[model samples]
Target: MNMCFVTHKVRKGDGQGRVNYEVILEALRQGHYVYIIASELSDELAQHERVIWKKIAVEGWPTELLRNQIFAIRASLWLTILRNRIDLTIVNGFTAYVRSDINCIHFVHSAWLRSKYHPIVERKSLSSFYQYIYTRLNRSLERMAMKRTRTIVAVSEQVKHELKGDAHIEGNRIAVIRNGVDLEEFYPRHVDRRELHLSEQQLYAMFAGDLRSSRKNLDTVLKALVSVPEIHLLVLGNTKGSLYPQMAADLGLGERVQFLGYRTDMATWMSAADLFVFPSRYEPFALVLLEAMAVGLPVVASSNCGAVELLTNKAAIIINDPDDSDALADALLRCAADRRQLKQMGEEARRLACQHSWSAMAAQYLQLIQETALHKAVPLPES
Candidate 1:
């Protein structure tokens, strides 16, 4: 089968990009001719013999919204022209356009618009105003594109629900395919706290992701840390110009919180920690949570996170309210109070993470693509 994939980026590091990258590799391994329409392509993917890279040069844009719009328009036009040659077309929601068979939506823009903690809702800056307008425009485009899509691949059941409820997409047309983590790259390892310059006796909780975003709900973690003095929080991800450092100081959590900034050795950091905390207000699917679980780290996360649905039993302590610092504090304290239970939960988390591998995820996507390609009928609208 000759497959065409349209995405903004075809590289690692990014969530959707990494997923696409894995799928493309799987498609190639399955002896499929894969064509990628992307703004940026990684060296490894670019050099693949079975892959065809159609790079769309996106530049000279003042804002990311404009750059993405330009790339999508260009890619859409190219897809239409090459529609005759391509057997099937799979597109990311961000770049969904004409001649798409399957639309794989990583994050529902409509869901973010409804989130009270989203930057567009919380921030009052000019940049936030631009983000507000951009989000609205993206939502409108996505809804229209989804209507025309033959099959919709949602990263989570939460996203599938939003697609049906908010975007008016039919439930039958959407398939829930949760995001996966590279188990080989993120499995548990023996890491000494002394190597990371931390006392072995001190309890450490790791929190990763863009701390600048209020949606991540890092402030709640900071507030919670104040109550759990024994548990020190190791902050990861980009910290440049973020107010989290200041917020920690203001909350009198200067000693309890340590901002490690963005580090490539996330597996090491995750393994070194006693637990992982991610109380995000809105998360379609957090790969970091899966990565943490892969490294045998018990998680204290919000029920709002889509990945939380995958965890069962005592694998994780899920909080009802992402903004409730007291609840988060209590969960952390409970985990710290019981070492044996915490260790058992970590083992359970690792077992769960191992079940959701990238290879398995790629196989599921391939099967979906094959099934969608066989059925040519247009999806019915929800009544």
Candidate 2:
């Protein structure tokens, strides 16, 4: 069988790219001839046996929207030139202009575009307008692309619903395939807080994301943490061009929060922490939540996160609203005051994270694509 994957990137570092990377590896492992049409691919994978990479480099483009458009054109040309050689074509949502067998959706632009917290809705600037156009254009293109594809694979139930309700695709059309974490890389390892910190007595909660945007909801976290003096927050993100550090100081949470800008050692920090707090206003599926859980750290996240659906029982604490600082404060205080319950929840989180390893997720994708090959998939609209 010849399998072709169409996406922008195929590397371990990126989120959506990692999914394609694992799946493609699985396809190769199964002895299938895999063709990757991507702008950027890991060198080792591209050099592997029976794997062909059609590099469609468009990184120099000024904006993401333009780059994607150029990539689609280049990828579409490649597909047309080698259509017969490919047995099945799997594409990420709106990646290429041509219709393919399976469409894997990472994020639903239509849903985010309509979100009250979207940049277009909350902000009024040229940059915000550009984002609106980018999202708006992608949303329209994705609808057409998803419609033409034989199958749709959503990264989460949250995205699945977005396709069904927002994109007007039927519920039966989308298959939920949550992203996987590298259990080996994320597993609990002892990290002595004394090595990086000034305090051994203070319980710490870690949050990681872009600090520049309120979309990640760091502002609300600062607001919530101002009251919880018992628990200190260590934020892992780039502080450059971000007001969060300043915001933390002004809010009188200077002692309560420590901003550790972006670093390669996330697993170490996560392992050292007592809790992982991510209350993003909108998250399709936060791999950080899963990664934190993988390291035996209890999670407190918002219900708006799609990944929250994967968690069951006491592994996570779900806050209904990200803006509710009182609730966030309470959740943090509860974990800070009770060591036994926190440990129990962290252990439970590890137990759940163990189930969603990268190998397991890749195997599921392999089996599904194999099944899809045997039977001709009917497009949801026509079916």
Clashing pairs in 1: none
lDDT of 1 by residue, 203-314 (tens): 8999999976788989899988888887988999899989999999999888888899899988998888999999999998899999999999999999889898889767
Per-residue lDDT of 1-383 in model 2, one digit per residue for the tens? Answer: 99899999999878899999999998888899999999899987989989999999896799899999999999999999999899899999998888788899988999999999899888799989999999999999999898888879998989998899899987876888899999989998887788997477778999999888788999888888887888889999999999998899999988888899997899998988899999999999988899999999999999988889878758888899998999998988888888899999999999998989999999989888987888764443452
Top candidate (lDDT): 2
Look at candidate 1 and tell me the lDDT of residue 350. 96
Q: Which ten residues in a row have the lowest lDDT in candidate 1?
A: 374-383
- The number of clashing residue pairs in model 2 is 0
The regions of model 2 sitting more than 4 angstroms off are: 377-383
List the global CA lDDT of all models. 0.88, 0.89
Estimate the Cα RMSD of every predicted model relative to the unseen true structure: 1.8, 1.5
**Residue pairs with backbone overlap in model 2:** none
